[model samples]
Target: MVTIEYIVDLVNKHNVWRGKECINLVASENVMSPLAKRLYVSDFMHRYNEHFEKSHYQGTKYCMEIEGFVKRIFGERFNTDKVEPRPLSGGQANLIVLAALTSPGDTIISVGLTSGAHVSHTKFGVVGVLRLEEKVAVNNEDLTIDVDATARLIREKNPKVIILGRSLVLFPEPIKELREEIGWDIPILYDVAHVFGLIYAGKFQEPFEDGADIITTSTHKTFPGPQGGMIIAKKDFPDKLWEKIYYTTFPGLVYNHHIHRLPALVVTALEMNAYGEEYATQIIKNAKKLAEELYDRGLKVLCADRGFTETHQILVDVRDYGGGAKVAEILEDNNIIVTKVALPWDTPKDATENPSGIRIGVQEMTRYGMKEEHMVTLAEFFDRILNRRENVRREVTVFRKNFQKVHYCFNNI
Candidate 1:
C-alpha cells in the first residue's frame, strides 16, 4: 500500500488543496516568496556549518560567507552589532537566552498564557525545563500588561529578567512605562515572534528605544522567511553575555543550524527593507477592516473600543456559535482556515477545548495579494458560516483562485 508514488501524490494533493484553494488565516504562518523559496532549495541544505569560537567543519567557504553576511546585515538592520543567527525556532531562541542568562531556580516574569504569552515564556514550557520560577505580569482587560502594577510587581519580585510580547498580541507592550519604573538593571526580552516584520518595517514599536534590551524572534511569521530564529541585542550589549550566547547557540544548542535557511533569510530581509512598510500597513488595515466588517455582521469581534487591533491579528469571541472548537472546525470544513485560542476569561476546561475565541490573521492572505476589499468578502463568508450556518467552500476556493501571487516583494517585480 505504501510507495514513493503514493507519498508524492499526497504532497501534490496537499499543495492543490491548501495552496491553491484554502484561504489560509493561520496567525503564525506565512509563505516564502517565489524568489526566497527558489533559493531555499539550495545546495547548502546538504552541508553543515557547526562552529563555536571556530568552525568544526570544512568545505564551507560559501556557507561561512552566507552565514557571516546574514549575521552582519541583520545586525545593521536591527541597529545592533550583536546577533545570534542560530536557534532553529523562536522557542529555541528563548531557551538559549534563558540558559545563557539565568541559572536554575532563578525567577523570570512573563505574561500569563491565558493573557496571550507564548508557551516558552510560561512555566509550562522552557522556564520549567530550566528549573526557573516564572511569575506573570498583571494583564489588563484588553489583554495588555497592566504597566503600573507590573512595575510594582517587578520591584517586589526582583526577577532576573522579564519577558514581554505575546502570541495573541494586539497593542504594543508598555515597555517604556515598565522601563521608567524598573530602570536599566534588569533585561527585558521582547519576543517579537509574531511582529518582527512590522517592527522591521518601522511600522510597530521600537524595541531598544522603548527600553527593551533584547529581542528573540521567529523569522517566518510575518517575516516571510524560512523557518528559523534569531536573538538580537543593542550595539553595546554586554560583550561577555554576547559571547556566552554565541557559544550557547553553536555547540550548546544546534550544530548544523540549518545553514539552508540563511540564504532565504537574507533574501527576505532585503525584500522587507525594500517594501515592508507597505506590506505591514496593508496587513493592519486588512485586520481592522475585517474586524469592523465582522462586527457589523454581528460577530463579537473583541477590543472594538480600541479600534480592534494595532497588529495583524483580531480575535472573535465565538462562544455563541457553538464555542471556538466547533466554530474553527466548521470554518475549516468550508476551507476558511484559522486557529482557536483562549481568551483572558477562559476556564481551564475551555482553554484546552471550546475556548472563547477564534484568532484571524491577515498577514498570510496579505502576502498572497489579498487586500481590504477582499477582507469585506471574507467577513461576508464568516457571516454566512457562523451567523447563517451555510457552507461556502466552493465560493471560498473560487475566491482564492484570484490571489495566488505573493505581493509586496520582488516576485515578478
Candidate 2:
C-alpha cells in the first residue's frame, strides 16, 4: 500500500535532483532566496484577501497593508504610481489588461512566434479565448523587431494595442524607435515576463521610457519573486483606463490573487532592489560568455555578430544535434535542464513539439553564483553531451554541488 510518505518522498526526490544536482538552464525559471522560501510557508496560505478598493470579507487588514506596500515599492522603482499585484499569473495580468482595453473581436499586433512572442499574445492562447484578432509585426534578420516595417504595418492595421517583449529574447525590442515612427495614438503593452528583474536593475530597456503605456510580467522569472504576476502603468496613464484595468482584475479576472505568496513576493521585491544590478550584470556576462563559448565550439549559437546576447537568454539552433526536442532530452538526461523553442525558420505548428532551437538562460544559475568562468565549464558540458555524444550527469552534478547556495539576495547579506 502506498503511504502519505510517498508524496513527501517524491518532493524530497525532486529537491535533491533538481535543487541540488541538476544545472537548470530553463529560461523561465528561478529559485527564490532562502528568506523568501523560508517565509513562504506561512499562515497566509490558508486565507484570502480578495479586494479592489474594499475587501469582500474581514481578516485582510494586514494583507491589504502588505499588498499596498509592495505595490508602492514597485511603483517607485519602475517610475509609476500604478502597479497592480492582484493577478495570479503573468498570463492573467495580460488577459486583464487586454480585456480592459479592448472589446471582443478587436485587432491587436504582436511579434510572431519566430520572433519570440509568447503564446498568450497569439491566437493559440489568450487572444483566441478572448476573441481578439492578432496580427504579426515584422521582424528583422537578427530576430529583433523591424521598426520601419512595423510602423508601416501599424499604420495600415491601426491595431488596438501593440504588445512587445518576447519569450526567446536576445536583444532589446525597438520600443522607442517604433513609437517615434508610428506616433503616439496606439498604446503599447510590453510583456517583460522574461526581463522584469533586468528592467528593475536598469540593465535593459525602460518600458515606460521607451513609450510603453503599460507592462505585464511574472514576478518569478528574472525578478526572482514568488510565482505571481503584476501589471504596472506609466505615470501619465489615464485615470479612467487605469480604473478599467483595476476593475478587470477584481470582478473580471482575479479573485484571491494568491495572498499566500504576498509575503514571499514582498521579500523578493526587496531582494531584487538590493542586488538586482549586480545580479543582472553577472547574468548578462554569463550569457554572453556561454554563447561565445558555444559558438566557438561549433554550436549554432544565434546572433554571433551582435555578441550573441544582451540579457540572460541564449538561443541555440540545435537542428544539427537532432532538433530542440532531442537536444533538450539529451541535455536533461545529462542533468542539464533546458526548454525547446522554435527558431525563425520553424512554423508555428512545429513550436510545441520539435522545434529547431533550444533557449538557455543563466539567471537562475547566476543566482546560484555561477559566473563567466563557470559558463565556460557549462559550455563544455553542452558540447560534450550534444556534440561528442557523452553522458555528463555525474560531471554536472559534481559541478552543481559547489554552487548550491542562492546568491545576490538578502540570504548572504
Candidate 3:
C-alpha cells in the first residue's frame, strides 16, 4: 500500500525544493487539482473491457459509474452531443478523429510546425507518419492562422478536413470565416489540446458554436486533470463515427485506460464546473499582466498592440538574449522555467539549438495561486537576467534556493 508519509516526502524532495520556482510557461501545461490527483492515484485496475461494458466483467459497475460521470460532466461543460474519454493521449484523440473522418489519401489543412500547429495534424508528425495528405502554413501578421490564405488554399486544394488550434496559438483563428468560405462541404476539426479547458472555463472562443464539427483535447492542460485525451463531436455525426472512436480507443489502440485516472477525470470536470471560470479568468489576467510587464520593460513580445494574448501564454522574441536556448538557459539559472519556441515562419536556422524566441505563461503558477502581481515580479526577474546576464547569475542562485518553499504537485514533486 501507499503511505502519505512517503508521498509527502516525495513531494517535498521533488516538487517544492526550489524558490520562486516552477513558473512553467509552457502553454500546454497546468498543475492538476488535488482532487484530480486523488482520482489518478486511486483508480481501479481492469482487464480489456473492449466496449463500454454491458457487463463485460462482473465488477465493472463502479467503473461504469465513474466513466458515465466523466461523460456527463464533459457533455454538460462542452455541451457536445457525444464524448469519448478513452484516448491514451491528445495525439491519439486526433488520430482516431482523423481515421474516422478522412481516408489515407484525403487532404487535410493545418498549420505548419514553425507556425505553432500540432504534430498530430502536420505531415511531420503522426499525420505524416500515418501517410495522410496535409497542407500546413502560418498567418502573415498577428501570428495566428491566416483565413484569407486558408480560403485560397481551400479553394484550390479542397481538403476534406481542416484542423485548427496549433500548439502556440494565442489569438483566435478564422474558423467562422473559414466555415463560411467552405460551406460545410468540408468538415473542420479543432485540435484544442491547449485551449479546451479555457473554453470550458469561458476563457476561449467556442469552436463548436463558431462552426467546428469536432474538437480534440488533452484532459490535463488547462483543464487541470489527469493526463488523458478526449474527443467531442457535434450531434450530427452518425453512430459509426463514435463506434470507430470506441474501437480505436480500446482494441484498435489502447487496451485499458488508467482506471484510477477516471476518478480524477470526473473530479476535474467538477472542479472545472465550479472554480473553472474564476481560475480561467485569472489565468488570462496573469498572462496579460506578464506580457504587458515584459513589453513595458522594452522586450519584443508578440501581439502587443493586439493584446499580446487572450489566453494564458505569451511568446517573446528573445533574439537579443542571444536566441531562445540561451535565454531559456539564463532564465533557468534564476529558477524561472520557460521554453524556446520556433516562430511559424522560422526554419532550420531557428531550431531550438538556436531558436528565435522564448515562450512563457502563468498556467502552472496560476494553479499554484499566483496572480498578476506575481507575474510582474517574475518578469522583473527575467528583465534583470536579460539585461544583466552575468551579474544576475549569483543573485539568481539565492532566488532559486527560495523557490523550494512553495508547494506544487501532491506527489512525485
Candidate 4:
C-alpha cells in the first residue's frame, strides 16, 4: 500500500537528517565531492562494459575511455601500471586477489577479527569462500601485530600469502620488518582500505616501498570517492601473476563491472592529486586531537601512549559507559554517528553483542572543515552525552549546521 511519493519522501528525509544534522564519525563512510557526485549519475550507469577492453555490447567507447583514464590516473598516482579499478567492493577486491594467488586448501596468514581485520580476510568471508585455511598472526600488548611471533608463525605455517593491514589500524603496519623476516618469496597483500588517502598523500607508510607485493583498497573510506575498490601491484610483480589477477577479476569474479563510477572516481583522483596532502594531514591531526581530548575527559582511548593514532580513526573503550551498542545508540540520538566495534580483548562471540569499543573517524568531518579546535568541542559533546546523560541533540545539530560545505575539493573556494 506504499506509494512512490512515500518512498521519495523517506529518502529525502534521510538525506537531510543524516547529511545535514548528524556529526558523522562512521569510519567507513565518506561524501564525494560536488563534481564527483555530479558525474556519478550518468549514462554509463545504464551501459555494460565487460572484460577490460573486450566490451560485451556496443556504444561503450566512452565508458572504455573513462575507465582507461581512471586506471591511468591511479597508475600515475601509485607509481604502477598494474592497477585494476573494476572490483565492485573492497571485499571483492580481496576475493579477486585470493583467487589469483592461492589455491583451494592453501593456508594464509592475516590479523584476527578481534584484532581489527576486515571480515573479508577471515575464514567466514573470501578465505572460506575459496576453501582456504586461515591462520592468524599474534598481536602485541599495544594492539599492533607482534612481528616476531608472526615471523615464527610464518616459518611454521608456511602460509601461501601474508595479509597486512587492519580495520582498527592506528599506526602503520611493520611491513618492512615483516618482509625482512618472511623473506621475498611469499606474497604480501596489504589492504590499504582505511588509510588510502594517507597513503596517497604520503602521510602514511608506503606499502609498495616497504615490499608489499600487492595492495587492495576501497576508494571511498579515506579517499573520498565513490563506493568501489581498486587493486595495485608492485612494478616488479611477475606478469604471470598479473595474468592470474586479470583472469580472476574478469571471468572469475565480476561479469559486468560497475562502469558509472569511473568518471566520478577520476574526478576524485584529480581532487586527491590536488588537495590530498592538506586534507590527509588535517584528518590525522583531528583524529589525534579528538582522541587526546576524549582520553583527557576520562575515556579509555586506545594507543594514548602511541599518540592515539596516525590515521583518521580513533578507538575508545566504552564498556564502562554502558557498552558500545548502548553508547552508540545514545550518541546517534544526539545527532552523532559512530559505530560500535569489538576491541582486541573481546572474543568473537562477545564481539557480536555487547562489544567494548566505539570507532570514530575524523576524515569526513575534516572534509566538512572541522579542525583540531572543533575536535575539542566534539569531545565535550561526547562528555555531555555519555557522562552527564544530557540531551544535546539540538546543540549538536546547530554545531553541524556550520559545516555543510565540503572542503579540500576543486569546487570549494
* Candidate 2 pairs with clashing backbones: none
Estimate, for each residue in 1-413, the C-alpha lDDT of model 4 and write its tens digit. Answer: 99999999999999999999999999988999998999999888898888645787888889888888988988887788899899998889999999899999999999988899999899988999999999999898566898889999999999999988889889999989988888898999999999998999899998899989999999999999999998999888999999899889987889888799889899999899899999999999999999999999999999888998999999999989988999999999999999999998897777998899999999999999999999999999999998899999999999999999989898952
Clashing pairs for model 4 are none
Model 2, range 247-294, lDDT digits (tens) per residue? 999888898777878888888888888888999999999999999999
Report, for every candidate in turn, its global Cα lDDT versus the true structure.
0.91, 0.91, 0.76, 0.92
Error of 1 at 381 (Å): 0.1
| TM-score of candidate 2 on Cα atoms, chains taken together | 0.98
Query: Model 1 over residues 1-413: C-alpha lDDT tens digits?
Result: 79999999999999999899999999999999888999999899998888864668888888888888888878888788898888899999999998989999899999989999999999889999999999989889898988889999999999998999999988899999888888899999999999999999988999998999889999999988999999998877899988878878877887788889998999899899889999999999999999999999999999999999999999999989988889999999999999999999998888997899999989999999888999999999999998888999999999999989898789673
After superposition on all C-alphas, the RMSD of every candidate to the true structure, in Å, is: 1.0, 1.1, 4.2, 1.0
Error of 2 at 47 (Å): 0.6
Ranking of predictions according to lDDT: 4, 1, 2, 3
> Which is the winner by lDDT between candidate 3 and candidate 4?
4
RMSD of 1: 1.0
